[model samples]
Target: MNVVTRSAGIFLLAMAAIALPGCRPASQPSGQIITLRLSGWQSNPNEKQRLDYLLRKFEKTHPTIQVKYETINSEYMDVIKTRLIGDVAPDVFYLDGFEAPLLMQYQVLEPLDRYITPEFNLADFEPSLLNAFRYRNQLYGLPKDFSTLALIYNKQALAAAGITHPPKTWAAFTVAARKLTVDRNGDGKIDQYGFGIAPELARQTFMIKAFGGQLVDQNGFATFAAPNSLRGLELIVNQYRRDRTAAQPTDVGATWGSEMLGQGKAAMVIEGPWSIPYFKETFPALEFGTAEVPAINGKPGTMAYTVAYVMNRKTRHKEAAWKLIAYLTGKEGMKAWADQGLALPARRSVLGELGYDKNTLYAPFVAGARYATIWQAGKHLPTIRMNFNNQFISALLGEQPLSDAMQRAQDTANREISWAN
Candidate 1:
């Protein structure tokens, strides 16, 4: 059967499974617990505390069911994939929206529609974000938290450069970056850079979209060779080569852009809302503010990354698993998590409750959600990313022309997709 038909079949089977008596294991002498495993990557101390509190509440509400939480410390995605392939995956686990398409294509995730009740209210989530986890009309995941990119700048750096506010247009940004960049000690060695760009798939994907370029076409083919896309790549490379105002975090062995900015080595960077809390805890003395990512060619844009709680297709305890998923994503759980203000809430009402709608620091990020381009999750995402990285780095090093590099990257990515098919 085709994908949609197969998805429908799965949904029907799930419904049948839920409806039939004896679907769950024997009631364990009426009082024993029904244990389920929930897995996710590591979280901060505060987040862990909150999760523990929520889990305790869940256990109290459903005394018969017990959840065993597990964590993978290293190579989380690889570990999760290996477990899924080995048929030992957790009943419920964290799934990034970008990876949902791949998991759905492999038919490894359970369709959630069968379990969603009237109380679930799937419509409460942002439609575009919810659509990210839905494949062939079957929802595979429910978003728990989300983040969008914004320009984070040092107030002192801008003042020293005679700038009063963050730049709003590409032209103004370029000017400010040049002025803010300096060889501070005048020893011909640059002590401070105007900006640092994180040289990763996520940041580059945002750059491509900001310039009105689609990384993949409607048919799920790589399409980064368009002129607009090439211009976007050029903009990044030129900042390092021509403007001399930007450097990649890798050049300094920093894993994230936020770290580069936190150290006071860079005056500006584009990062997500998560960085705010991270910096607040890591370096309370640093002074900074966030602004919407400057428009490129007069268009507002940014990149949004989100993760959802999903069920495994092979989960034997479907009912118990649904209950756990529901509680984690429900109004109560969402409010508890979002109240910490570490990440943006995926639910609309929870965002308002958390004061994100009125907080000026968070308002731009929420506003950008409507225009932000989401990362793609085509079957060939891994291969496409590899090629894009290689070619992008080559352009950054002046080893190839922007157009030539992008064309070669596109060709390589398309070939990989063809091989996969």
Candidate 2:
């Protein structure tokens, strides 16, 4: 018997043996407790507190089941993979879309399709995100939350620039960015940049795909060096290296785009829902607004990221583990998690109930999900991402032309993929 069933049998036998004087068959009122282990990476203090509150509520509602939560903040993927190989992984754990393909291919994750019921409403999930964790028609994980990139701009800076509204297209966005670039002290040095950016491939792939550019061919070989693919990326390179209007976080001595904007070093940024909490807590006095990512060639595009709660196939408590996963990803629990606006709800009903679609601050992000490119490829994506980022940064810094930089990146990435295969 499995761990959950074995534990249940032991409880029943103990109850029969210890039928004491005048004691009912069910020993204690609530009966024996079974514990399930869950592991995930640590985010912020607020996120942790809310999760704990929700978990405590779950425990209260289901008195017969208890949960054991563990956090591994540093090198999360490495730690999780190690535990999986060691056969000591938790019953349930956090999994990102980027890493799901590799684990699913190995068949180490439990197939969740059997556990889902009609009332669970699998159709409630966003289709693209839901499809990301499916392998060979078998559902393996349920997306707990998702975020799509949107235009985040400082309102005071826009007013200072004499702009009335956010840009609606690529041409307009570029023009506004230039106007937003300012030298407040007139000291021949920039006091604030127009845009703050990150040069990583994770953020740039959507740009590559925006104008019909392909990241990989049918065989999963790197193909982003093609002229058509480079077309969209050239705009970013021009803004950063030629116009000198945009600054990376490192250039402004801040850790990320959100920080640069909060510190008044950058007037605008493209970011996700997680930035909402940071902005409110870090710079309560700063005025900002969210808008849909600017359209490119009259077509809108952005990137979407999702995280799911997956079950370990080696788990001894399959039945109990499924219950925990079901509750967390269900309507009630997801609403409790997304109500604070830290992450958008993955379930459609919960989103509609929370009224985020009507909220001006979050509508942009929710709307972007329809057109955003998910940041996932084949199993070789992790390898391809590293090579692309290295050369992509070189191009942004004017070390070489965009075409040449992409060529070097594509060639190197393909070679690595061949070696791994």
Candidate 3:
């Protein structure tokens, strides 16, 4: 029997035995409780509190199971890898899409297909998010939540600049950005830039894809130095260097793109739904709005980041661990979790149930989910990302041409990947 069926049968038999006058079921381990260790990095205190509440609720429904949740704040993936090597990893844990390929490749994660019941409604999840955890045609994880990029612009700045609406295409966006940039007080220094950008690969990968650029070939070698990739990359470089309408967070003394927009150092940024509550709390009076990330070459594109609940292959209690994963990623639990709006629900039904598609600020992010490039490449992505970020920033700062920077990044990344293999 499948784990789900067996578990249900055991529960039903135990209930039947309890109904009899003095009969105790031999199959039931008298008052035996299984404790599951769960690990994830905490984004904030509220997220931790909310998860604790959800765990309590799950324990109530599955009375025999208790979950001990741990937060590994720093060096999360490094800690997880070490624990996996030591066989001391949590029974169930969070796995980011970017990191999933390596874990799945190493065969350290349990294939969840057998444990999944039809009633689990696996199809309810967004296919792209689910595909992130699949390897060799087998599934390994269930996405807990996700976020997609969108254009977040200052509403007041647009109006003041006589732009009635947010730009719908890259060309229009460039024009709008030029108009929005300002240098007040005749200081010769720009007081506000039109756009704030993160030059890291995570944010720029979509740009690579925007113009027929591929991050990796079928053989998983870095190919981002190809001419097509540079075409898209040069747009960013030109905007920051030639146009002078874009600035990085450090240039304006801010820490990230969202902070730059919030601080009025930039009039626009491409960000995700997490920035909504952040703006409301940090910049309460900032008039902001969101739109689908401006189309590139008449094609819409964005990036999606998702994290999943995956079972450790070595867990003693596979069934129990799956029960926790199921309940947490299930419709009810997901709805409750997503109600906090920390991230978008991975389940399509839960997203609709929460009415995120109707919310003005979140609708663009929701729309982008359909076409967003999942922020996952092959197993060598971490190495590729590191080299790309280091070199891409140099190009953005005008140290060298975009072509040279990308070629150097690609060559270095491929050498490391080849050595590792």
Candidate 4:
């Protein structure tokens, strides 16, 4: 069998092992039922439904353990921090890649290296994704789901514009976008835009990387003011002003790329796997396809957002908590989650079994995995995001030049980094 097929076979074997009766370790059960609290931000109705099912299955398999689910609706990080300080934190919680560094620095999370078993096959996860949760070579969390950016386009819109396929280069992309934009009613107002670009830290960060700009220096100092970085920033702003074919999410009060594309207000967007299920459910009538993100000056690029399951350092039930985490992130649970097509799996083996390799809508996302840039994790991410968001929004409003805005953002981010140090 080929490498992918072989990996899939191994993953199936692992799942079988997890599903077998009496798969728990030989250590004696405490004989007392334990209740574990798990918490995370709710994404959508589908995610909640899947999680409820998984939790119920876990409860059935381990009769001695009861799981309680809680969600913080406002300011997730702040609420989680407050609860941790109050000594009432959940036993397990979702940790975003950008926030992991801050939490790890505060010594709030328990390192999970001790709980890793040979059967867990940590090597199965992408090394880059796994590195996000590591502190001094000690693993702290296991990735649950990951997302990578891809070009999502409306097939009908492309056909109407006389374009045979999505653009492959930035030059062609601009041309196609201009062609697709229309003032359909002769009201001198553009009714359809070719693209929807969100003006936010995450999107800008990805752009900077696409143009070969690093957000931080070797010592983790902010470096977004570099010339190439400014060039990258100008590329998107120019597309908005010069071409008039792109609209920001704020232009339509749409919070995300999927919504704008779903409404047919935008013909194309750069989004992640999460939008797949959202589109399938929210706008079932719309026909769309995805391609790898267009090359920037001949170099392919995209962004990745990942989250992991982490344990509380002060939890009284470390052993039981680890068991639950292992099972949830193991081959069985990971396969089940990925199979639902809600999000891409972090493991290579699971992706094959789910047929993501041959799936045209999902193949670009998978192909971009190796080249996609992961969001930076550090003690200053929160501050950096705040500074970038403010300046980027100003640039988007045409109040400042892209160069000036990026320089100011870099300076402000550096000051925050200095203060933290």
Give the candidate number with the greatest TM-score: 3
TM-score of each: 0.90, 0.91, 0.93, 0.90
* C-alpha lDDT of all candidate models, in order: 0.80, 0.86, 0.89, 0.81
lDDT by residue (1-421, candidate 4, tens digit) is: 3343343344334333332222233354667788899998877766777777888888888888888988766789767776775667899999889888767655678889988888889999988889989988888889998888899999999999999999998889889889888899999888789999977778667678766787887777777878877767777788788778999877867887789999888999998878888899899999999999889878988888889999888777888788788877887888876776767888888888788979998999999889878886476666677778889878877899877887898887776566545
State the displacement of the C-alpha of residue 140, model 1, in Å, after optimal TM-score superposition. 1.1
Question: C-alpha displacement of 242 in model 3, angstroms?
Answer: 0.2
Q: What is the C-alpha RMSD of each candidate to the true structure, in Å?
A: 5.4, 9.4, 9.6, 10.2
Worst lDDT window (10 residues) for model 3? 17-26
What TM-score should be assigned to candidate 4? Answer: 0.90
- Runs in model 3 lying further than 4 Å from the true structure: 1-30
| Model 2 agreement with the true structure over 355-409: per-residue lDDT tens digits | 9899898999999989889888876787788888999999888888889999998
Backbone collisions counted per model: 0, 0, 0, 0
Model 4: CA > 4 A from native: 1-29
Clash list (residue pairs), candidate 1: none
Q: After superposition, how far is residue 345 of candidate 2 from its true place, in Å?
A: 0.6
RMSD over all Cα atoms, model 3: 9.6
Q: What does candidate 3's lDDT look like per residue over 3-39, in tens digits? A: 4334334433433333223212124365789789999
